[model samples]
Every structure is written in structure tokens, then in C-alpha cells.
Target: MDEISLLEQGVSFVLHIDQHLFALVAEYGAWLYAFLFLIVFCETGLVVTPFLPGDSLLFAAGTVAGAGHLSYPLCMAVLLGAAVLGDAVNYEIGRHVGPSIFSRETRFLNKQHLLKAHAFYERHGGKAIILARFIPIVRTFAPFVAGIALMSPVKFLSFNITGAILWVAGLVSAGYFLGNIPVVKNNFSVVIYGIIIVSVLPVVIEFIRANLKK
Candidate 1:
């Protein structure tokens, strides 16, 4: 097996890579936190890449904090900033790129999706961006979709701020609290596994419903 492919190794493999750099991440904890945040931000912010492990990573990081390796408050702060900044950047990208989507020659991009995002924007309006924080892949796609539809910038920011705070605070706190349980402490991997499964449920349900309706 190859030693360094995300495909071959999966999340555990990636965490091993994170562990290798744990010492360095710990040395400049804030920077490390920000670095992880950016990745999460980009993953959520970019429509092309909505598969990042925002939930699992946050939970695992919180668990790490519970063990005294990382500071919980700092971890929360960094991840929150990452979550918020990610949305903001993604919103800007959408705002700028929306018109280009109008061109006929755009490859692999669908105008219908932009329309759909707009529809979603209308139904849920701004809160979708913020509420989307709880769901895994959707959180990433929401902003991009919103931007593609040219959602109002001020409205996006309002929900984005609310969602960022709630999203980050909720997940971090979940880990901090549950992670300290005796069973959870001993079975961190099990907990993380469950988190991953739960995180993906929203996407799965939507996928199934979409197919079923057709």
C-alpha cells in the first residue's frame, strides 16, 4: 500500500499525518488552529470540495483537548474563526464568480444549480447559510450555492456570523463534554466513527429523497 495517499489511508491515515505534526501545531497552537480552520473553510467555502471532515476533525480535536494536549478554549476559538472566515471567503468567491456562470461555455457547471441555490436561498433565505453549519458537506456547499445565486451580501453575513458562532460552539462543546466520559475517553475512535456517520446523514437523506422523488 502507498504510504501517503488520502485515497488509500482515509481519515485515520490523515490523523496520523496530523499527529506527526502535533508537536509543531502545539508549539504555535493558534497558528496550527488557524491552519486547520482554513482547510475547513476552503472545504466548506468551495463547492468543488464539500467532502472534508469538519465534524470528525472538530470532535477529535476536542477530544485531544480533553486529554490536556490542546487547550479547549483556544481550540474552540481557532475553529470558530476558521468556520466563519471560510464562509466569508466562499461568499466572496460566489459573489464574484456568479456572472461567469452565465456564459454558455462554462464547463461542468450547471446553470440550473445556480437557480436551485437561489430557490434554496429564497425558501431558507439567509439562515440556510448559518443553519447549514450543523450538517457536514452541506455547510461547505451552502455558501457557494448562495453566491452562485447572487444572494445579498449583508444578509449572508448576518446569518454567517450567527451560524459560525453556534456551529463552532456547539460541536466544540459536544466534544469537550462527551469526550471526557470514561467510556468515550477509552473509545475515542468509536466516538469519532459515530460522529462521521451522523455528520453524513443529512447528505444521505437528501440524496435518497431526491432519487426517490424522481
Candidate 2:
């Protein structure tokens, strides 16, 4: 598919994850768990796939689970594992490529994003690993930048695991509890957009702050 079509499909999925995800779970049955795992993995693990649904998907999954369509424990476990493993793989890839990779530009990779993530890492140090988990594009690039900076594997793993757990659990649990409310369930699109806005707020604030400093 072309870029515009791909973008549109992704947006649609995120906005209507409730309906699309329910149909997926219903049709795929047990395999839906694996599918979700792959989606989460790609979104966090691959820089080029940052546009893939992340926060919204998890929320929708939790909503479905709350409705008794899927097992919450199993859903949580699968996604959490995918997220941790994805970051580990991304970090390893960056470590192998080193900092030089960031100097080169490609259609799939954005240099500005790498620079922003690198700066975020430098300013926040180790905490950037956890903080980036809440930001969309940065979340994908943070581990790679950490690896380029040659962060210790043990140190990276500690924060990576912690962030993954907190991110997945917090969003999913919120959907489970809040999504079940009559108002929320009836107007889930609004809640999903709210989640998206809140998720990206940090990046927006940082962008503004950087410009102000300039």
C-alpha cells in the first residue's frame, strides 16, 4: 500500500480498535494473542514501524478483556513480553551498528528523531529509558539511542523491563476500569483520542521548550 493509504489504515485501526479488535479476536480466537504480541513488538522494536498502533491497541485490548472476550492476564503477559523483547532487540541492533548509523539518512529513518531521542537520553540519563516509554516516536528510538551511547546491558534491561511493565499495565488497566463505564464505552473514540493526546503531550512540550531555548 501507498504511504497515505497505510497512514489512513493505521489511524482507522487506532480510532476503531474496539470494533476491529473484537472482530479480530473473534475470528482468530487463540491466535489473537500472538497477533497482538507481534503488533506491540513491531511498534516498539522497529523504528520504521513507529506509526503502528501502540497505546490505543493496548487500551482496546484491555477493553475487550474487560468485556470477557479475552483473558486479561494472558493479554497482559503477551504484550508485556513483546514490549521487553522488542526493546532488547532494538538495543542490540543499535549496539551492533554504533553511533555512525545515526549520521546516515534513509527513507525509513529520520535523523531529527534520532537527534531528539539522543538529546532526551543525554538530559535524562538512564531515566529516559522509562520516560520515553510514554512517548510514541521517542519510545521506538530511545533504546536504539541508548545502545549507540553504549549503555550497559544490565542497566538498560532494568529500566526497559520496568518501563514496559508500567506502560502496558497502566494503559491496559485504565481501559479495563474506565472503558467499562457507560459513558466511556459509548464514547470510546473520545477516550482513545484523549489517550493519544496525553501520550504525545510530553514530546509536544519538549518541542516547544526547545524552540523557546533557541
Candidate 3:
């Protein structure tokens, strides 16, 4: 598909994730797992794809699994790995790009700034990485920034694995256990919009607070 077509489809998927997921389950059947895996991976991995569905997708997948169309345990495993590996890859990319930007001063960028960022990330990377996993868009950029700041791989991995487990298991299990409720099932799109808002609420609050401080 062309870029515009892809963008339109992506937007449609995000807005109607539950309906699209149901259609996917109907059409792709077993192959839906791979699609889910890719969505989770890209949403978590690529900075450009922060717009892709994460929380809602997981919940919808869990709902499908709960309905017996998919396997819950397997889905959890697949997504957990995708989440972790995606962050890892993003970190590596940032790590590689960071040095070049820092090796020399630009008209606008300075080595001292990068040094301060590195120091800040070193001190707070662990908690930030774990917490960021729950917040949309922030989760996508947190690890990349950590890498740009050169957070320790060992420390990053520990928190990355822990956060991925909690994020995938917690949301998916919520859907598995609760998604079938008549009210949630009937209002799945509303629930999805609510999830997206809640996921980004922290970022929104922080932005508002920063603006007020200024």
C-alpha cells in the first residue's frame, strides 16, 4: 500500500481497534498472533510508531484470547518478548547515534549537555524505565533517551524485562478476566479511547504543569 493508504489504515485501526481485531481474528485466525506480535514490537520499538496502539491492542488481544480464539499464555509470552526486544533495539540505535552527536559540538548542540543527560539518566534510568512502560509515547522514547544518555545495559535489561512482564501480563490479564463483561464488551471502543487517554494522562499532566511553571 502507499504511504497515505497505510496511514489511513493505521488511523482506522487505532480508532476501531476492537472491531479491526475482531475482523483480524475472523480473517487471519492463527496468523493473528504474528500480527499482534509485530504491532506490539513496532509500537514499543520504533520512535516513529509511537502513534500505534499499545494498551488497547493488548486489551483487545486479551479479550480475543479470553473468548478462546487465541491462547492467553502464548499471547503474553509473545508480547512480553516483543516489548523487551523492541526497547533493546531502540536503545541500541540511540546508543549508536548518541556518540556521533556528542563527539563534536554542533551550532545548537553541545557535549556538555549530552554529558549532563548521561549523568541524569545514570542516576534515574532504572525507575524511569520501569515506570515509563506504563505510559504511552513516553514508554517508546524513555529507553531511547536512556541509551542516548548511555544507561548501563545490565541495569536497563533488568528493568526492561521486569517492566515488560508487568505491562503485558497486567493489561492482558485485566482483559482476560474482565473484557467479557457485558458492559465492557458492548463499549469496547469507549474503553479503548479511555485506555489511550489514561495511558497518556501522565504526559499530558506533566506538560500542563510545565506550561504553568513557565
lDDT of each: 0.70, 0.90, 0.80
- Best first by lDDT, ranked: 2, 3, 1
* Of 1 and 3, the candidate ranking higher by lDDT: 3
TM-score of 3: 0.84
Candidate 3 residue pairs in clash (backbone atoms < 3 Å): none
Error of 3 at 139 (Å): 1.2
The list of candidate 2 runs beyond 4 A from truth reads: none
* lDDT for model 1: 0.70
Candidate 2 displacement at residue 24 in angstroms: 0.5
Put down candidate 3 lDDT per residue, 1-214, tens digits, no spaces. Answer: 7999999887677767767777888998989989988988987787667767889888988888888888999989888989999999978877887557656766643344345334434656578788888887667777777888677999889989999999999999988888888999988878888888888787677668758999
Q: Could you say which candidate leads in lDDT? A: 2
Candidate 3: 10-residue stretch with minimal lDDT: 108-117
Best by TM-score: 2
By TM-score, rank the candidates, best first. 2, 3, 1
lDDT by residue for model 1 (1-214), tens: 6756756567664444325335656687556666667767766666656656677667667666766767888888888778878888888887787667666655544455455455556667678787678776567667877776777888888888888888777777877777678887677667766766776686577669868999
